[model samples]
Target: MDRTLTDIPTAPTDRVYIVIPLFNDWEALSLLLEKMTKTVAPALRKRFHFLIVDDCSVTNYASLPTDTGYSLSIMRLWRNVGHQKAIALGLSYLADQPETHTTIVMDSDGEDQPEDIARLLEASAQKPGQIIFAHRTKRRESRLFRTFYLIYKSVFKLLTGKAITFGNFSVIPPNLLRKLAHVSDIWNNYPGGVIRSRLPYQSVPAERGARLAGTSKMNFVSLILHGLSAISVLMEATAVRILLFCVITAAVSTVVITVVILLRVTDQLIISQGAIYIVFSLFIVILQAFLISLLLVFIVLTYRTQSHFIPAKQYGDFVEQIEKVY
Candidate 1:
C-alpha cells in the first residue's frame, strides 16, 4: 500500500526533522538555527529536531552552539558533494529512523526563510497526502540573475515539456522519505529528481529571503551546470525534441533548395551569386542536420543500456562517516 500523510497522524509530541545541508556557511547556519527558536512557533518548537548535514566543511561547525530550545544534530559527510547530494544523503539517513514522521529540507543559507516554516506546516496539516513546497512568490536576486533564471526556465519547458519553480525548501511526509531516497537522480538535482519521480506536491506562497551574510556560492558557471543537470534528467525527452528539430530543418531545407534549383533551371527567375550561395548553404545545413539527428538517436540507444544505482539500495557507498551532535 502507498503511504500518505493522512495515513499517519502527528501528535503534539511527534517530532519534525528539519534537514539542512551545510558547506562552509557556518555563520548563516548558526544565525538561522538561533532564529528558528524564536521564528518557529512555541508548540511546534517542542517537537522540532534540526538535522544539519555537513558537506565536509573546511570551517569547523562543531563549535556552533545548539542549545537553542530545540534538539539538534549534525551529520558530517566524507567530502563535499555539493548541496543537493548532501540533502539526499541526509534524507537517506533520516528514512531509517522510526521516530521521524515529517522531514523538512531547506538550505543553510537564510534564503529559504525560517519564518515560512510555520506556513508550510499549516498547509501540510490542512491537506495531508502531498509534499509541500515553499514556492517563491517574490525574489531577492539581482536583475541579471533573474534574467538568466527566466531564460533557463523557458528553455527547460521548451525541451522537457515540464515546469519547475520550487527549490530545496520543501516538506516531505514520511511516505515519500523512503521513496525519494531510492531516486538516484537526487544525487545530481533534488527538485528535478522529485519532479521526475512523479511525486504529488503542493506549493505555498513565500518570498525569497536575503542571505544573512556572505556572497552566494553559485556563480555563472555553476548556474549553467545546475540548469544542465535539470535538463539532463529529461535527457530522452530533450534528445527527442532535438532530433525532431533536425528532421524538420532537413526537410524544410530540402524543399527550399529544390524550389530554387527548379526556378534557376527554368530560367523563370535570375539566380545571382547570393542565390547560388543560399542553395549551397541549404545543402550543407541539410547534411549537418541529418548527421546530428543520427547521433542523437545513437545516444538515446546507448543511454538505455547503462545501469544506474538506486540511492536507497546503494547510498552507503557515498558516505564516509555519520556523526550525531546535540
Candidate 2:
C-alpha cells in the first residue's frame, strides 16, 4: 500500500523513532518505508518517527518520494560513513532529541521484519535498561553466505567468549541508548561493542524477509573487512594463544635436542645424526623467533590499555566520515 506521511498517527509526548541507515539502496528504502507505515501496529503508529540517514548516497534524496506522513526526517551526512557509523549518527541524533525515548535501528533492504517492531518495543518496556536485538531463527540467504556467517559466528564466540548471532536490527531503550552514546568506540566495533558491554539485553526471534528492492550493498570484500574488524576485538585472546603455542613448541624442541645429545655422549649409539641436528637447530630457531615476536606483542598490549590499543577515537572519526561526499 502506498503511504503519505499524513497516514501516520502522531502524539506530542509519545515519541519513538525508527532509524534506517541508507547507503545506495534507495529503491529498497522506499518499499521498506511503505511497508513500515502501513503494516506496523497502531499503538506504535502514533509516536513513530522515521529518520533516514543517507550515507552519502550517490543519488539525490530530492528525487525520492517523501509523502509518507510519519515525521520523516533525513540527515544527509557530509559523506558515506559506512553502515555502522551511519547508524551511530542516527542513534546520536535520536538521543539528543528530547522527545525520543526509544530508537529502533534496522537495515533499509527489508531483511528485518517491520512487524517485529512491536515485539522489540514490548521486550524493551519489560527490560527498561536493555537493548532488544532481533535474532533470526532462519536466514533466507544464499548457502555460501549462510555458511560463512555460521563459521564467523563460531570463530567470534571462541575468540571473544561472547555469543552474537544478531546484527543491527534492535530496539534500544533510552537509558541504554544514553550509555551507548557515551561509548566512544561504538562505530568502530558496531555490534561487538554492544556484546562486549555485557549490558542487560534480550533477543526476540524474528523471521527474516527478502530484500524489498535493489541489490545488497554489502560486497564480499566489505563483509570480510567487517568480519575482521569485529574479530579484532579479541586480539588479546589470540595473542595469548599464540604466545603459549610458541613457548610450548620451543620447550619441547629444547628437551628433544638435549636428550639426543646426552644419548649420543653416554650410549654406544650416535643418536644426534647430522640431519637430525640440523633439523632440530632450524626448528629451535623458528620457535625462538615466534616466541620473541609474541613477547613484543605482549609488551605492547601490556603498556597500552584495551581502549588505547584499539584507538577508539581515530576509528570513530574514520567511521563518522566514511560516506562524506568529497
Candidate 3:
C-alpha cells in the first residue's frame, strides 16, 4: 500500500468530474487543485472537472484562490450536514447533469491523495461497469487513530456483516451513478450504503497520504458519530441481530428459571433463602429479554414502513446554490 508516485497516467478522453466535500479546508483544497492542474496533462485536465461541495463553510468560497486552468465549480449547501451527506448531495446533483459520465468522490484533504485518483481511474477502465474503490492498504495516521479506526471497522463488520475498507474515494460509472442517487442510505454512509446497494464494485489497494493543510476536523466524538451513521444505514440487519441475541438470552433464562424451580421444589436447602433470588433474577431476565426482542421486531417493522428520502428526489432541497468558477 506504500505507493511511489509514478508518471501521471493519461486520463480517458471521456469527461470525468471529481467531487470533493469541503468543510473549512479551503487552504488544502486550493493547494490540491493547483497541484492537480500541474500534475495532469493539459488535454487530460481539460476532460476533468472539479466539483467542490462546500458544506456550509464559514469562509467565503470566493476568498479561496482559484486555478482557472482546470474546470471547477462549487456547490454550496443550505446547511452543514457533514461530509458524507455533502458527498451524497454532490453525487445526487451530478446524477442529473447530462455531461456526467464518471464521478470520483474524494476528500479535499490530501489524505485521499490526488495522485491515487489516477489509479482509481485506471481501475475503472479495467472494469468498465464496476465501481472502483480506493481500498486502504496502509494508513498514515497516529497509533491511536489507527487503533480506533480498526476497532470501528471490526464493529461495523460485526453489526452489518459486511467489511468496508474503503471511504469516499471511488469512481462511479454513469450507469451506477443513477442507481446510487436513489439509495437513501448513501446520505448517511457512502461506503456502507454502496455495499448495501448490491452494485458490483472492485477495490484497488491504495496507501493513505498525510493531510495537506490543517489538523483533521474529525475528533473522537465525531468519529463515533460517523461510525454510528455507517451502522445506522445497516439498521435493519443490526436490529435483527439484536433480536436474535435477545431471543437467545430469553431462552437461556427460561431454562435457568426452570432449573431453579425444580431445585427449589426438590431440595429444601437449595430453596432455603437464596433460591428465591435466583429464580426471581432469571424470571426478570427472561421478561426483559423477551420484551426487548418484541420491541425490536416492532421497530424493524416501523423502519421498513417509513418513507426515507431518495437522494435523486431530495438532493435539491439541501442545495443553496451552484457556482461555476471556471
Candidate 4:
C-alpha cells in the first residue's frame, strides 16, 4: 500500500469532520464543543461537523446542549468498547460519509488543545495523504507517570523499530482513514498499525494540559493492560530480539568454556572461583537458550493459529451494535 501524503486544495469545504470519543465527561465535553466552535477557522467553520461518539457513559448526554452553530452529531455506542475502539468507530462512521475528505480524532476531556486543529489542517493540506500526529512536547502529568511513559516509548521503539510517541490525537486523511478502517488486527496494535502502515505522516509538537473536567478514567490496571496489548502487537519482533540475546549468551558461554580449558592446561585457573563461575554461567546460558527457543516457537504457533487476532469486521459490527441502543 502506498502510504504517502500529497498536498491538495486548501479551499474550505464541507469535507472535514472532527470526532471526539467521550465516556461521561459531560462538562468537559460541553467545554470542548464551545472551544471548538470559537477556535475553528472561519472559512472552515460552516463546513466542519463535530461527531461525539459516546462510549456508554452512565450519564445520558442526549439532552445536553447541541446548539454549537455547526453541524453536530452524537453517536452513542451500545456499550463501552474502550477509547481506542470508540475512536475507530467514529472514524468508520465518517468513512462511510461521502463528503468526509479528512477526519480529526481527539479526546473530549479538553486535554488536547482545540487551537491545534488549525496546525493539523495546515499540515494535512501540505501533505494530503499524511496523518498529522500531535506529539506532546512537555507533559503536565506527574513525574512517575512521565517516567513510565518514557519507559514505554523506549520499549515500543526497541520492539517495533519505530519512534511513535504520540497517541490518538491526530488528523488522518480520508483515504488513509479508509485503509485503517479495514485493518483487522487494529485492536492488537493500538497505534502500531498507524506506523506500520508506513503511510506518509508528520508529527507536530504540542503541550499536554490537565483534564478540563471529571477524573481520568484510566487506572493502573487499565494502563498495564494497554501496555501489554501493545507489546503483544510487536511480539514477533520481540521474539527475534529474545533469540538474538540467546545467541549472544551462547557465544559468550562458548568463549568462557574455551578460556577455562586453556587456563586449566596452563595452570592459570583460579581453582575454586573459576570452576564455580564457569559452571554457573554455562547453566544460565543453557537455560536462557531453552526459554528463548520455546518463546519463539510459541509466538510462531500463536501467529499461525490467529489465537489473539480480532477481525476488524467483528470489531466494526460490535461497535455498530453499540451505537444502535442503550
Candidate 5:
C-alpha cells in the first residue's frame, strides 16, 4: 500500500514520558500530540510528558505548537543521527529520572497509532517491570516492501538465532532504564538490542496506521540500511553463523571433488572435459570459503576486544541544545 502521511486518524498512559524523534515532520508531530491528548484517560492528562529528539532538521523548529497541557521538551542534536540513535540518546537523557515512570518510544508520523497506546498502557499495568512493544498484526506497506521485509526477518533470525517481532514502538519501564540506557547495541537498533539483551518483553497486537501529514522519506535503500542496522546489533553471532556456513560449504566441496576424482580413476564413470573443469573449480571455491571463514573468525575475536560507545555515557556529547517548549 502506498501511504502519504497527509491526514489520518490514529494512544493512553500514566505520567508516561513519550520519546519521539523528528526530522522535518513538525506538522505531523503537532497533529500526533493533539490526538494523544484525546487518547489517554481524562485523569491522566498532565501525567503524559513528551521528549522530542530533533535530528538536526533543516526545517524550522518554531512550526510546533506552543500551548499544550503536556510537558514538552525538545533535545536538538549537533548532527543528524537516525531515529534509532536519537531514541538511544533520549533514553539516556531520561536514565536518571523517577524510577516509577515509564518511557514510551513511538513514531511521530502516525503509523504507530496514538489510540493503541491505551492498550499498551493496560498491558503494562498487568505486567510490571517488563518491556511492552506494539507488534504489527497487519501492515500496510506495498507488496514488494513486505516481500523484502519477510526476507529480512528470516535472515535476521537465521543469523542472530533470535526473532525480531517488534520495532521502536515500545513501552520501556523505568526500573530497567539505568541498565538499559547504557546498552551499546541500542545505538544501532532499539528493538534488536532489547531482543539481544534477553530482557523480559511482551507485545500487544496493532494494525499499522496511515501516515499523518507528509510522505515518508523511507525508500528502498533506506529500508535496506534499516535491515542491516538491525542485523548489525548482533554482529558477533552473525559472524559466527556465516563462518560456520563457509566451513560447511568448503567441507562439502572437498568431499565432492574427492569422489569425482576417485570415480574417474576407478573407471566407474567417464568424466567429460566440462565436468572435469567443474570438479577442479571446487578448489578455488574451497580456498575462498576458507579465507572468508578465517576473516570472520578474526572479526569476531576483534569485536570482542574493542571498546564501544555506551549510550548513557556518550549521548550528551551529541546533544547540541535542549528546550522545554510547553
Candidate 6:
C-alpha cells in the first residue's frame, strides 16, 4: 500500500532528534524505526538520530540491525517510571545536550504513527519558536475505552478550565527544550505539563494509527492514573474549582435550613416531625461542605508552598546506562 506524505523543508545540515519512550515494546519500536527510515527524505537519512528511552524493559531488541543509516542511542532506566515520566526523562536528557535542534517526543507503539513526524517538523519549520503537538483527529480505541476517555476529558475541562485536545506526540523546538525541562508538570504528565508550561504552542491534526504489534498496556486502572496525573499538573486550578463548589453547597444548605426553621416556627406551613430531621440533615451537609472547603484551601496552600520537581536537574538519577547500538 502507498500513501502520500508531505515533506518538510529541513536544511541539509540540520540535526533532527526523535525521542521515543519504550516499555516492553521492543518489537513495535523496531518496526517503527524501520518505517521512519523508509519514509524520511534521503538527505535527512543519516542526520536523524533516535533517542530511545527504555523504561526498564524486560525484553530487548538485542538483534538490532547495524546497517541502518540513522544512529540509535538507548537510555535504560534503573526502574520503570511509567511512559509519561520516561518521556520527561528523555526530553530532559536532550535539553541538557549542547546541540540546539528540534526533538520530537513520541511513543514506541505505532499508535503515534511515524508518518506524522513530517507534519510535526513542517509545523515547526513554519512556526519556529512554538512547540507543535499532534492533535489526534481520530482514535482507534474500543467503544468502552472511548466512552470512559470522553468522560475523563469532560471532567478535566470542567475542573481545570482548560480543554486537552492533544497528547504526548509533539514537536519541541530547540528554543523551548531547556525551559520545558525546568517545568515540574512533566514529571506527572508530559502533555499536561506542556500545557501548564504557559509556553507558545500550536496543534496539527493527525489521525491516530493502529498498534503495530502487541496488546495495549492501557487498562481501567492505568486510565484513571493517567487522568489523575494530567489533572495533577493543574492542581491549583482544580482545587479552587472544587473549593468553590463546596462553598456553594454550604451556602445553599444554610439557606434551606433557615427556610425550614422559619416555616417550623411561624405556623406559615404545617411542618411535620420530618421537618426537624430535614433541618438536621441540612445542617450536617453544611458542616461537611464547610470542612471540605477548608481542607481544599489548606491543601492548595500547602501545594503552592512546596518545591517543584524540575526534570532537568533530576533525570540522570533514573538513567542506569546509555547504549549506542549503531
Q: Which number leads on lDDT?
A: 6
Query: TM-scores of the models, in the given order?
Result: 0.91, 0.79, 0.90, 0.85, 0.92, 0.93
What is candidate 5's local distance difference test score? Answer: 0.81
- Which segments of model 5 are wrong by more than 4 Å? 1-14, 62-69, 98-100
Give the C-alpha miss distance for residue 54 in model 2, angstroms. Answer: 0.9
Kindly report which residue pairs in candidate 5 clash with one another: 1-141, 1-142, 5-213, 5-214, 11-114, 11-115, 12-118, 15-47
Q: List the residue pairs that clash in candidate 1.
A: none
Q: What are the runs in model 3 whose C-alpha is more than 4 Å off?
A: 1-13, 38-43, 61-69, 268-272
RMSD of 1: 4.4
Clash totals for all models, in order? 0, 17, 0, 8, 8, 0
Model 4 root-mean-square deviation: 5.7
Indicate the worst ten consecutive residues by lDDT in candidate 3: 1-10
Writing each residue's lDDT as its tens digit, candidate 5 over 1-326 gives 11111121112334678889989899889888777667655556566677889999999654665433457778889999998999999898888443336888999898898888778888988997899999888887889988888888898999989888788998888788767887899999999888777788999898888888899887788888998999888998899889889989999999998888888788776656755986879989999998998898888888789998899888878888777676
Candidate lDDT values, in order: 0.81, 0.70, 0.83, 0.71, 0.81, 0.84
Residue-level lDDT tens digits of model 4 in 150-188: 887887777767676787788988778777766544555
lDDT, model 4, position 254: 77
Worst 10 residues of 6 by lDDT: 1-10
Question: What TM-score number comes out for model 5?
Answer: 0.92
RMSD of each: 4.4, 6.0, 6.1, 5.7, 6.5, 5.8
**Model 6: clashing residue pairs?**
none
Displacement of residue 180 (Cα, Å) in model 1 is 1.0
User: Which segments of model 1 are wrong by more than 4 Å?
Assistant: 1-13
Tens digit of per-residue lDDT, candidate 1, span 1-326:
11112223344546788899988998988888777777877777777777788888888764665565356766767778888888888888777555547889999889998889888988988766788998888888888988898898899999998888888999998778888888888878888888888888889899999998778998778889999989988888899999989999999999998888888888875746767998999999999998999998898898788886676666566666555455
